[model samples]
Target: MTERKPRKDAVRNREAVLAAADVLFTRCESPADVTMADIATAAGVGKGTLFRAFGDRTGLIRALYAARLEPVREAIEEGPPPLGPATPPLERVPALLDAVLCFKLDNRHLALALEGNGSDSPYRAEHYERWHTLLHDMLERIPGLTDSAFTAHALLAAVRADLVEHLAGHEGLPREEMRGHLASFAAALLGTRPRGG
Candidate 1:
């Protein structure tokens, strides 16, 4: 028995839907404002096609978010330091957190939508687990750093989308300043810098 491939039209429609949805999400103030019907209309497809291409709104959002994150994931997974695996744990840990912060900053609205979608805890997200595990392992490599697991969670929480949005969007903190603050905070924990320096 041979596996059947998706029809050409189906492939085309799926691409159109994803492209349309990406544009809609990028322009919308809130993810909730971009409905499946809106995406279907924008993509020039029927509602049924939209649902068929992506199971539901959450599924679509997750897909879009994952697509946007692909480059960052690749850099972290294989590209050069300090995000790549070859970097020392001490240097890589802060770089990892910084990269995460910048990603949230760049994708503020989408990050907020996905993490605050209310379907479930952001902690349950696969990306969250990947990041947490990476950070945990890095933290464990630091000498005298007990509670690496809890420390990793704490570090990640500090950069949570909502908190970042609050600080950057609401409180009006500058991006570089926020990054500096996070780097300094992490440095203290790693004992690489003086506290509050």
Candidate 2:
């Protein structure tokens, strides 16, 4: 039998709970400070429902990952708004890199949560594939890549999130410089004649 889904209000409450948890966890320097009850209060949902819906801390982390995914995917796959149709795809590339770095900087908590979860979830795989595929697509449009995938893979590794974060955060590189370097590096790897190249 087809089971009935939760009511619209219940779905909305679940979304709110996830969003509240996301904000709290992502912004907190110490993730241990976040609690289910705290998320429930912040989301304006009952504590019992929170527990029932998310089960526990790990559950909440998974929910946060799932909740955050759409926006991340959209930002990368679909150019962020305000840039609109005016920005050429190549021109928007550096902006996209900056947006990605900003997302990681803002949501370091979710990255921490994903640290332990292996390749079991489809989400992590999707994230990897999206970046790799996007890099491949960009490389193919380069008017050079006789072997686009190989060149694209190399470009992807260069600007991979961990490396970018290490350079920008730990190494104390300025964000603008990091973005510029990544864009330039990717163009070089693909042998693309970038605007400034």
Candidate 3:
């Protein structure tokens, strides 16, 4: 059977809720500071609507994050070289890491909301597994690289949401500087010269 589409009102409500939650997450000092009730209030929707649409707080955050991450996913999966599959592994690996770092930097609040939910380890999240698997596969393709799994995990650790917040928020590292550092780190790991160096 064909899948049924949601009602127009349902679609509108979901967008409103997501927008409201985005604002709340962006402004709050901590993800825990923004609650479902706050989101419902900001969206002008009832609590039941949110629960029905998202299941729980974690569900809502994941949905929001996935929505925000769609472009990155598309680029990596099918777009042109560097991020796309057509690029060589050595180039693509650092490009992939750069993309992830940029995304986390751009969506620091939302990222923290999803990764710092405290209900479960972020490593177990579907998104994390996808990234790990992608990175592992790419790392394996690069000659002289060993322990692709551990290496992927280690590289990803540099861009973790908490660490991003600590660097960008607390340490006040400039965004370009952070990206530069990450690029250098990736280059060192891949036995490459840092970009523009």
Candidate 4:
């Protein structure tokens, strides 16, 4: 049998709910502050519809996070240099980390919500595993880098959402400065000098 597409209203409701959740996540003081009911109200849908569509708050958050992260994922998977598959491991590794750092910086609230959700460990999240695997594989391609697994984890830890929040939100570090610091750190581990450093 052929797969059936969703009805028009279902499609519309999903988009509306995602948009409302996006706004709520961006504006809320904390991730937990934005609830399913609030998103339903904002999207002009009922709470049952929201739950039926997403399963629960965590499900909704994951969907929104995935939607927002699609571009970055596409870049890494298929786009040009620094992030694409064709890039050299050394170049791609740092580029990937930088992308993660930048993404977390850009989506502070959503990143925090996804990472901070107590129902699951951030390290075990599907996105985190994908990043770690990609980074680990890249690290293995470099001539002298050892402990590719640990190195990948360590590099990722530097850009963890909470750490990003602390540096960007609490310590007030400038974006360029943070990027520079991360580049320098990644270079030190990879046994190369950061460009111009």
RMSD of each: 2.3, 4.5, 0.9, 0.9
**TM-score attained by model 4:** 0.97
Enumerate residue pairs that collide in model 1.
none
In Å, residue 31's CA in model 3 sits off its true spot by 1.3
TM-score of each: 0.91, 0.65, 0.97, 0.97
The TM-score obtained by model 2 is: 0.65
* Candidate 2 stretches greater than 4 Å from native: 1-5, 30-98, 119-124, 193-197
lDDT of 4 by residue, 89-138 (tens): 98898899889999999899999999998997889999899999999999
- lDDT, candidate 3, residue 66? 94
Report the number of clashing residue pairs per model: 0, 0, 0, 0
Evaluate all candidate structures by whole-model CA lDDT and list the values in order.
Answer: 0.87, 0.65, 0.94, 0.93
What are the per-residue Cα lDDT tens digits for candidate 2 across 31-60?
667877788899998888887887777776
Model 4: number of clashes? Answer: 0
Report the C-alpha displacement of residue 99, candidate 2, in angstroms. Answer: 3.6
Kindly indicate the candidate among 1 and 2 with the higher lDDT.
1
